[model samples]
Target: MSISTVAKKLPTTAIAATVIVLGIGAVAPVAQATVLTFDDIAPISYFNEIPNGYGGFNWNNFNYINGSSPKVRRTGEDNGRVSGDYVAFNGFGNPALVSDSVFDFNSAYLSATWNNGLSVTVEGLKNGATLYSKTVIVDTTQPTLVNFDYFGVDELKFTSFGGVEPNYLGGTGTQFALDNFTFNEKATSIPEPTLLPALFAVGTLSIGSVLRRKQLNQS
Candidate 1:
């Protein structure tokens, strides 16, 4: 109510404002995970070509097949599906790519279509440049869950190379299947550089308020 009381309260309020600004600056950006199981694609008797814009990513040389489809040979597709009845594979044993503007590749369940111990090379790329790559061996007998944990990539290229070929459904030994593909649609964020100026301004105001209070006490 008095002039001295109001002056004391002014410093406390300014310090609180400075703390609030610092608290906001300390917050980190959160990245949410997105799982693309390929189960959303309608099943055909044989295979379904995954189109662009499916799960917000462009799919190249990828096809989905129903695990129990009559056209699917049981020997080739055995244990290929991780969830639901559908699974995605590189059509014709070609190198495949799943791309977006930017994303974080988390993990995926992979299996060879016809070959056991198939060598699959997965590369993370940004702006047409390779950021990182990992090679993992998979088998048709069971699905191998590979954790990539790659962040801030715009493209993921999968190349299947040498493996043991079995003459069953006439599949190339290089062919591989993908299921339960998980990723983050966005990259993790860093605190904005613009926040620094705001924090500095608030700190200065807090210091000025404290100095004013000291001067009043001295008087």
Candidate 2:
């Protein structure tokens, strides 16, 4: 109801109701960010298998897994990295990583060994169509953290640039890696069980004021 209408009715009750509703909002639970460290996934380095049911099995939580040749370099490994190990794309005449299972990934950090045309693209797909896409060129010798923090998508596609050959030790393809690869976790619109203690205290005070005002009007 409008302010004038509420004021025309029982002012104390309406104001108290508003206060209680706002108190609930102030005490709502918040969503947290989920980071994919790719650290404890063992010493395995190759994400270079076909998707599940074809010749692979979800790549251990990473699904829709299809690409030229992708590999994961674990932390503490002797792989050339800024610090820890990371995942890289091997140029098997083609260097691309595609997936639709990483939902709600806002931004990612990539590490490259200065390979030419090192590009990464992320997109949102719906019903086998491209909803949106963002591409980045990674030409660096260190671990670079790139942000697509503006849009949230259902599908995430990471592709290393082409025209380069695979030489994991010193050449072109598999020398690229993604380290500290992370994403955020978000909560649904569902509300929690109850409000915090402070919100309850304020709500009680608001109700008390309404009762006091009612008594004064009755007198």
Candidate 3:
């Protein structure tokens, strides 16, 4: 073909190639969600604490009461047994006390940004007896994502207390906590469209170079 004809075709070819690459990238698919499982429990004491007179344990002073009924008194052995301190929940109290305490699992303050959904399940056995067992659904739509803090207390009134025995206080055998928390997200359905711009830029440069060389030859 003549030089003029070649120059005319160069730009079209470059633009076509750029468009094709952009199309390919835009049609690419995204990724899938992930599941999380916990074998060991992590403490969130920053948000949770045991209150005095609520249970035999006082998280404020890190002490445990070691007496029966109204005679309950603080003991050194009761310290640091429970994970999170009080105030982790909107209203911190022993769930076993009057079956009124609702532990907030979002206290971990873990960020779940861009997550499609979050599922949390808490299971604990105190004193060889089941203290709390429940799964909480968390909404992750907010731009400012925050996780709940989990807390537990030793109540003298609950069967989970293991016969009001102080020896079983903080041992893993008697007190247990777990969080089966999972984060999920929708897979990227397509590759980013950014590639289109890049491809176009490269193609434009290629065509410009070809035209410059053609002009030089004609001169």
Q: List the candidates' TM-scores in order.
A: 0.80, 0.56, 0.25
How high is the lDDT of residue 44 in model 3?
34
List where candidate 2 sits over 4 angstroms from the true fold.
Answer: 1-14, 21-28, 44-83, 88-102, 150-152, 163-170, 191-219
User: Lowest summed-lDDT stretch of 10 residues in model 1?
Assistant: 2-11
TM-score of 2: 0.56
Worst 10 residues of 2 by lDDT: 60-69
- Number of the top-ranking candidate, with lDDT as the measure: 1
Candidate 3, 63-155: lDDT as tens digits? 122211121112111121122221122111123322223222222222111112223333443344556554443322221122422234222
Is 1 or 2 the stronger prediction by TM-score?
1
Candidate number that wins on TM-score, 2 or 3: 2
**Per-residue lDDT of candidate 2, residues 20-53 (tens digit):** 7655444545556555444434444344433332
Clashes of each: 0, 4, 23
Global lDDT of model 1: 0.80
The superposed Cα distance between candidate 1 and the true structure at residue 38, in angstroms, equals 0.6
What's model 1's TM-score?
0.80
- The superposed Cα distance between candidate 3 and the true structure at residue 170, in angstroms, equals 12
lDDT of 2 at 41: 44
